[model samples]
Target chain A: MKKHLTIALDAMGGDQAPAVVVHGAHLARERYPDVHFVFFGRSDDVQPLLDAAPLLKKVSRFVHTDDVVQAEDKPGKALRRSRQSSMALAIESVKAGECDVAVSAGNTGALMALAKFILRTLPSIDRPALASLLPTYKGECVMLDLGANVECDASNLVEFSVMGAAFARTVLGLQRPRVGLLNIGVEELKGNEEVKEAAEILRTSDLPMEFCGFIEGNMIGAGETDVVVTDGFTGNVALKAVEGTAQLIGRLVGDAFRSSWRARLGYLLARRGMNGLRDHLDPNHHNGAVMLGLNGLVVKSHGGATVEGYATAIGVAIDMAHHNLIHLITKDLGGVAMDRQESEPLTLETDKQAESKSA
Target chain B: MKKHLTIALDAMGGDQAPAVVVHGAHLARERYPDVHFVFFGRSDDVQPLLDAAPLLKKVSRFVHTDDVVQAEDKPGKALRRSRQSSMALAIESVKAGECDVAVSAGNTGALMALAKFILRTLPSIDRPALASLLPTYKGECVMLDLGANVECDASNLVEFSVMGAAFARTVLGLQRPRVGLLNIGVEELKGNEEVKEAAEILRTSDLPMEFCGFIEGNMIGAGETDVVVTDGFTGNVALKAVEGTAQLIGRLVGDAFRSSWRARLGYLLARRGMNGLRDHLDPNHHNGAVMLGLNGLVVKSHGGATVEGYATAIGVAIDMAHHNLIHLITKDLGGVAMDRQESEPLTLETDKQAESKSA
Candidate 1:
């Protein structure tokens, strides 16, 4: 039998820590018995709950760490000072080859810092990017650098496209994923100088992904592109805006349903469909945020994630490990580099002509 | 009755031209008998709509212009070549003192270019900003540079804050409108170089608005800020993301209601509250995109706006004119230059303490 992927998790992180993280671990263990978890943090904080579970004992290990990086800490100073932080140690375990993957719901900046410092970045990658899969009408769209690198140059976006496409293929199971640069408009010269320069590089890059040109925020959720790339600042804003609006509208709908007995009946009747949609659109279900272009697998959960969110994150880590995503990314990008060196100037003109007319 | 603010309308512009514009003019005129519109286009194109409606004849005046700017045309070339374009003539009407304001539901770039060329920017304003009122938990929030200047520096954002504040105070009736720089975090030193520099400048800018420090996208709809200023690229992405999420959630709820009989009953029972919410969240109710920092008043309607959306935009323009928004912006910013010469070093220690505590 194939061995389950071993993942080191920071159990002391997030708003709903210990309880939610413990619940998540139980759910994941039940679903994937082959998976093993090493819960890192203060054992005193978790012993009572850990002592209560029998099945959890068979699937889990624990690493005691006493420190944590606070959310409000200065990124540079906190990352430097928190040598014994559970988040940092969890990632280090992956780097030390003790685990296949690491998961954290701690401070995002600290996670990114620790991942970058310990796991290191892949070749041809200036800075590793964070990518998330968002549900859309057609299917899920992958948007990268969702708040990793603040200022990205042309080369940075090209790297994001390649990494994002590699992710879509390995995790999302897409073939030749179409990549797009996020801009204010779809027009070629519609954005700032950064975008204009990036478009030129992406158009000519020998990356395995199909560079689908520029896309707008409205188009991102509409599933116009399989992989969308943008600098971290803009991506973060866009991601948060979508999240905020969804929560607002969800609240509005919930309030409407509870307004009267008739509406409650309507909600009851629609419970099945609502459940299907709830399963589909729930961020908790798609909790894992992959730190792409990194040497090892790392997932960051939301700071306020509940138990279900952590379990979903573990599931994502297991999936990535099963598919050997890191090896696949290396192979894909390596092949692209090899092809670029051997081949003559390819028929980009044909591609451009085809791009001018599309579905 | 107070006469409606006379706004010159570029009738030949937009996707559903002549029809939407004419229908909007009639609707506004009927609803608010004081409102008046001056339509500029090939008189023949607009005359047909007016020929059918006696009420439109009462609300609108026609000006003949032979040229029109297509959405596809390059903005710079379009503005330079289409000297006799209806959109240009409409703005010129405002500059020529023939109208109180100019309204267009045209190619955004072309409209911006024409407004800048014809109306010119107000003194002390580097670039005019497109400030749109977004519905939030706390009534409405002013989001500026929603796609005006793509590239902006520190000084540009300070100017945006001044102009946006004036609009919020005069148009939205916000008192001491709290202006926040849109950044990734609330920290004193966070975000990109542009945002950091802008935050510093805002600290000392002698604008009439209250500088409330940094605000992130999630905090926007939470009523933490009254006016949020960012570079155009970020603002545009945020706005589109919010709009897209609302649409997606709307689709999900509609699907739920149609999925089962009980859900249908629930929807019917909740119809009143749901309707209220749908109306509250509708983008049309917040249709005005005021071009702040311009010497003359200019408002833009969405290119694909319905007649109702156009009417709301007209109402917004009327309100701005009535509040003397243009004169207020000029006075506030103009006074800054004069105040610097007149006053001694304004010790803002108490203000800084308040800001630090708030941060």
Candidate 2:
């Protein structure tokens, strides 16, 4: 028999929380029969929802908590005051080894703050980054630092690149993922100081990954690389821009089809093809945004996600646990750390020499 | 008789130059009979192309220049060395008042650098911004600082807002345009110090425009505001991301319709509706990216634009000249400068009081 993996869920989070959370767990349970769940929310509110899902009820345990984190609560305030909230408790369960991974459809800032405060960062990791799989023309690619560290230095960007590579390898099952740094232009001297410095490091570093120079925002959709690394500010804006454009196109297409009877007839005949396109581009298929560089696994679902989207987030968490994502990241980051240490002294010497020459 | 506007064209610019430039000019001449053209390039290469279009040849004159700026030429290098090149001469014509505006499908960096060098910036404008019209749900909106300045301060952002509003009013014919700062979040406390500072100023200042606080990247396509303001780095990335997403969707839709015979039949029946969508979303329909805040109007066409796209770019330049865009920007910027001076003393006093308190 396969060993069962436990997932801790924030039952009282998201727009429609307890119902979608419970139903999503049942869907996940059906897909992965050896998975169990630990629900963190008020017992009275969650019990009725769980009762409807018999399979989930059989393999679930509950840690009742009356407290909840409001979506608009500040991250600092939530970290200090909402310790017993469902989102916080779910994170705590992962830290305590009661659950293999934690999944939450809650306030992103609050979840990140609580996860960082409770679970801590992995060794040699300065900051944790948010990563998600984005659909591209060639295939799916991983993009990192979605909104975690908004203003990142060269070191933070390098760390994100490493984390994103590990994610692409573990989740996407790629033997050697080609990573690229996201910049305004592909030229070496195109961006600001931090991005240029990061690109230089990635180009020269002796890491166990394929570094494909630099990629522009348009290249992200073209699937030019398996892993795209960027500072949180640009990454977050770029991700949303892509989503917005896709939605705008979909709306325009619908309006066009509805404008004429001939088009409506065409829609009926092409329903299967259109369905395939819709399924491929659906947000539900790519729901979870994983927080990397953490000691334990944490997946954040969109607060406005539907039942199917929430279930997909749960599925992402399961896959991470099944593949031992944390272990893969640690191993790759360990190599990065060693490489940095060996090169640091040489880099310092070079900098000092250049400064002396300029002086 | 209506006043005629003469446009200087860089005949040796873009991928398919000389031919496309002459053809595009002819198309523009057909649309606006009052517009004349002065083409700058080698006469040997340009005369044959001009001969093919009798109407254009009758209304156009050529300035012979053997030198041309390569696509890969460095902006600074081109500015210093390529003074006699076709692009430089076209810009010089605008500066000399020989032409109302200059249109180029050449290098963007080269054009910007030369335009800034020769024509100079408006009196109250510290940096010239790149503004382009983007299609939105409501109709169309203007976004600025596309790639002119990668790093911008609060003052620069405020200037972009004013410039963008003026562009919309002059070109899109909006009575009172709503301007918004593009940010990671709509909350007052989100984003970096520069953005926060800009928001505070826009919120408080009286600049003869509607300030809609902060709008996210997704709001760009939602038609949330008439002007979307952001730093050049973010603005450029967001614009390209939108274009890339549109292209990706177009590809996916084509693939979907070709998947089965039914879909193909549907495609034939729905061809008219699909054509409408294609026309609306075509880059050729919106081909002009104007360099705003310059003393003279300068329009940058896509480097790889076809004849129709090039013609559309010429149309944009003509509209800007006809509406007196520079005069509108000067008037708006004059108001902004007055507001700044009125608030400077009070801001200085507040800063001193805060410093004294800290001491």
Candidate 3:
């Protein structure tokens, strides 16, 4: 493995910004000591925390920026006032190749917006997508277009399949990931025209992935495919619903154990095993959601992520950098344009980072 | 409470067919003594089962129909071969008012098509939606457009909200159920044009429901609202994904208990409380999915549902009939058309029963 990877940090972002950023970086450093971080935030706000953790300061560089992107800012507004902001500067460093990757605990739309404008998408990619790792019964699967582009055409779906497959190869270390389109049904003739057309194109294309025809939402957690491809609208809803179900189950489990004294005694005896189950369901275990298909790697950590969760997000950035994610994406997109050229040329208007980000 | 109610059953429908149908009806009868059943299936297939359960046969009438609707048949194909089919006859009885409501453990698309053809929709409803009860943390909530319409407009969404609200009122016994428009984000200006426009219309229109502005997929299981309204495509994916998550958590919990002897012992101790949790997660508890906006009530049960599951489905139909679902839906949709006229005339072409059922 290549050593000495420097990650650009959007220190003044997220719900608990500078402290979580610095603390998360320190925790990640313990796991991968050779890694370096360049923090972009107001020095006064970030430096005091970094100073408290002496070892983290030794290998890190802090670049002061007075402006922090507000969580509520629309993508267009965030970009219009983007220059010299911590998020902008952090992304710029990666554009300049000063950092191998960028990690941010920030608003998703703002991060996607900045990442798209600063780094741009790969040559073959029509629209870059947001991808995340979800824990399945067997292991993990990569699901894409979480919320970046709500409306996608056949070309966009096809592109997502390619990007998703490549990310699975890089992060999950799968050689030929099984890529399936997310649809209402697995029937050959199911879904809208775009989904069917995309499946048809994928069926014939020589993409560097196993093209599973169609997989339903229930199959996502059953480990039916290594990578799931879909429009952001369906993908986003499915993901959040899965999360909601997890929460519902967790609460139910807790309530069940606490309902009576006998159950409480059993819970005590099964505490070790139950803890393992909790570990499986923790958001920290699956913290990072990568904005794929960009020229540079950009990983978005949850805004409410704790030190451990943010550190896991950093680990994702490190993995992407170590595994040559950009090159992998480029390689996957290589054969896509050749097989299918008859579809309508893609439009850029529908692929906004956020709903009100038209400007 | 009104006790005497007649329900039409497509006895030859579902994977377990006449056996599950007969058993489920008997189970429901034990709970509800004054109920009557009209069995629409081959008497030879259903007769033996009814003979085994004498009390069921006492309150039921059998109408022989040799033809059975296959699960794989497209909606249009099913309709083309509709005459004397068990599903068709069962729905036709509802149309003819021989039964208070129709319950079928058949394919959804086929049931929706036959229901729409024979019963027709109410004057105010442009398209009927597939609605189901989902198990949330606190209790249950109604979710609509499970897979009836792939593409929905503002008018259709507003219609769904109205229908879903009425159904919640009928089944859940809430006078004015809190209705939420399912979207990717809960922000004011998130999701697509249809969702935004629907929110605007519902905000001003005198719909007979509490218009909770927007709810995310994650909040569905958290009991954010009593009714969730969305396009069929997203609703289908979200519901199935939630089911998948439940399966995953169940498997994980099972594995955790089996990992060691101590856990196995603990499992024995916690068996009672754990069983309650299992009941909460059981598919049988949330079995029925109603096809709303029709002139008469139509309830679709899971094809693979066991006796208890189909009983729950029957229970849903009983509730609908008892509370006058059609009247409630008509009242809920009463003031919607007057306030919104700017949207393009509702298109019947986009609202398909199934993907390949455009015919």
Per-chain TM-score of chain A in candidate 3 equals: 0.93
Ranking by TM-score: 3, 2, 1
lDDT of 1 by residue, B91-184 (tens): 9999988899888998888888888888888766767899998888767889999988776766677778888899888768877899998887
For model 2, residues A10-79, the per-residue Cα lDDT tens digits are 9999999988899888888888888999999999999988887777899999899999999989999998
Please identify which of the two predictions, 1 or 3, would achieve the higher TM-score against the true structure.
Answer: 3
- Clash pairs detected, candidate 2: none
Report the alpha-carbon TM-score of model 2 versus the true structure: 0.93
Off by over 4 Å in 3: A1-3, A337-359, B1-3, B337-359
Model 3: how far residue A270 lies from native, Å: 0.8
Q: Candidate 3, residue B149: CA error in Å?
A: 0.9
Count the clashes in each prediction.
5, 0, 0
RMSD of each: 8.2, 5.8, 3.0
Query: Mind giving the per-residue lDDT tens digits that candidate 3 earns over A2-103?
Result: 468999999998899888999999999999999999999998899899889999999999999898888988999988997678999999999998899999
Kindly report the docking quality category of candidate 1. Answer: acceptable
B285 Cα displacement, candidate 1 (Å): 1.1
Lowest summed lDDT across 10 adjacent residues in model 1 chain B is found at B338-347
Name the best candidate (by DockQ): 3
* Candidate 2 deviant stretches above 4 angstroms: A337-359, B337-359
